[model samples]
Target: MIVSITGATGFIGRRLVQKLAEGDHEVRVLTRSKENAKLLFPVEKFPKITIAGEFEWKDCIQGSTAVVNLAGMPISTRWSSEVKKEIKDSRTRVTSKVVDLINGTSYDTRPSVLISATAIGYYGTSETKVFDERSPSGNDYLSEVCRVWEAKALGVDKDVRLALIRIGVVLGKEGGALAKMIPFFMMFAGGPLGSGNQWFSWIHLDDLVNLILEALKNPSYKGVINGTAPNPVKLTEMCEKLGEVTGRPSWLPVPDFALKAMLGEGATIVLDGQKVLPLKAQELGFSFKYPYVRDALKAIISL
Candidate 1:
């Protein structure tokens, strides 16, 4: 399959490209800087992979079997007013551009599938309820961002198969929520945040990638699918598991007010939480290699 991807240098996109390349698929990446792309991907080894400048829409989408849109501003940064606009505009603009490109092009030039990225924040911050693909979006900042992002993505021509993966906190060794927590956890300084009662929907990086592959292969999979583990964990439980895996203690608690004061609205991603379930993915017969948080943390930490 010929796959074109935006944000190919990002954490998940980098890994997805590598995996697709290893599978002997033709992969084209849309990036801002070719030099950085080379530095990040080291294309010398993977000849099937090609990196090009940011979405010259038609140029990037032409002759591709699928287009995976992962381009967006990072949510981990402090949510300044400007940064918030950037976060919204980054996603919506890219998605709108892609849709326009596909619509403007001939049928032969357009991709068959459009796989877009979103976040589980679509379900909002819930304490105990488990949200699935059918769940209504919440009114929070992240949730609104996700709604707009997905809406733009789905605005592509009706002929194309559109699939949106509403992702959760991905646990990976190199980079992600896990990487940020490992050092503190290893030093026995990591603990639950706020009241530690909020639910955290998480997924292993491998599982997330595999789920994407599955979605690409299965024509029946469409709309929003939760890219998360079936077993959701509470904030306190996740912290305790990390401590257990690293042989540390998680007795300290970061106050919610302090986090909000420090990160602004961005803190809600950590302080407020959601219990998301990968119901559609599971029903499609996708199996998770790392279903439990403890085992996933152990594998990532060992790496």
Candidate 2:
């Protein structure tokens, strides 16, 4: 199968591309620069991969079996006015362009499926209950971003089978939330941010990649699926797990006011949390390798 992917150089995108390549699928990556794409994903070893610049969408989508739209600005940075606009534009504009290209062009050789990425932020920070695919979206910055992002993706032509994955915090050995917290945890400085009672929905990278692969192969897996572990742990539990995994005592806690002062509104992502469940994915026979936080933390820290 031929696949076209945007944000192919990003943390999750890069891993997803590698998985697809290993599965013997041809991949065309949309990048800002062909040179940078080559640098990120070497074409010599993986000749089935093609790297093209931004405007190559129409050409790249043609003759593809699937398109995974993961292009977006990182939300972890401080949300300045400019940064917020970049985040919105990068996701909505690029997605709109891809949808137009697929619907307007690609008629004869159009991809059969479109897998777009979203976030658990779609549910917002709910202190009361767990959110599933059927739950209504929350009203927050991240939720608003997700609302528009998913809307743009869903606007794709009715002929295509579209799947939106509302992803949670992805735990991985590389550059994810866990990686950044390891050093602090190792030094026994790890503790919950803010109140520590907020619920956190997360998924291991291996499971996340496999979930995408399953979605690619299963026609029944359409619509919104929570790309998260079934077990949702509290923020305090997460901190405790990290501390235990690293054999360090979690003796410190970062106050909500301090976080807000340092990160501004962006601190909401860490200080506030949502409990999300991958109910649809589980019903569709998707199993997580590390459903528990302790095991996931151990696996990542051991690496």
Q: Model 1, range 1-303, lDDT digits (tens) per residue?
A: 999888888889989999999999999888778898888877688888888876454786888899999999889778988999999999999888878777777898789899999999888887867799999999988889999999999888899999999999998988877787778777767899889999889999999999888888899789888999989899999999999888889988878887888788788888889888888988888889999999888887788
Off by over 4 Å in 1: 55-57
Candidate 1 TM-score, C-alpha based: 0.96
Local accuracy of candidate 2 as per-residue lDDT tens digits, 1-303? 899999888888889999998989999998887888898888677789989887787888988889999899888767888888898889999899889888976577998899999999998887788899999988877889899999999998988999999999999978777876777776767888888989989999888989988888899989999999999898899999888888888769878887788778788888888899999998998888999988988898888
Residue 264's lDDT in candidate 2: 83
Per-model TM-score versus the true fold: 0.96, 0.96
Clashing pairs in 2: none
- lDDT computed for candidate 1: 0.87
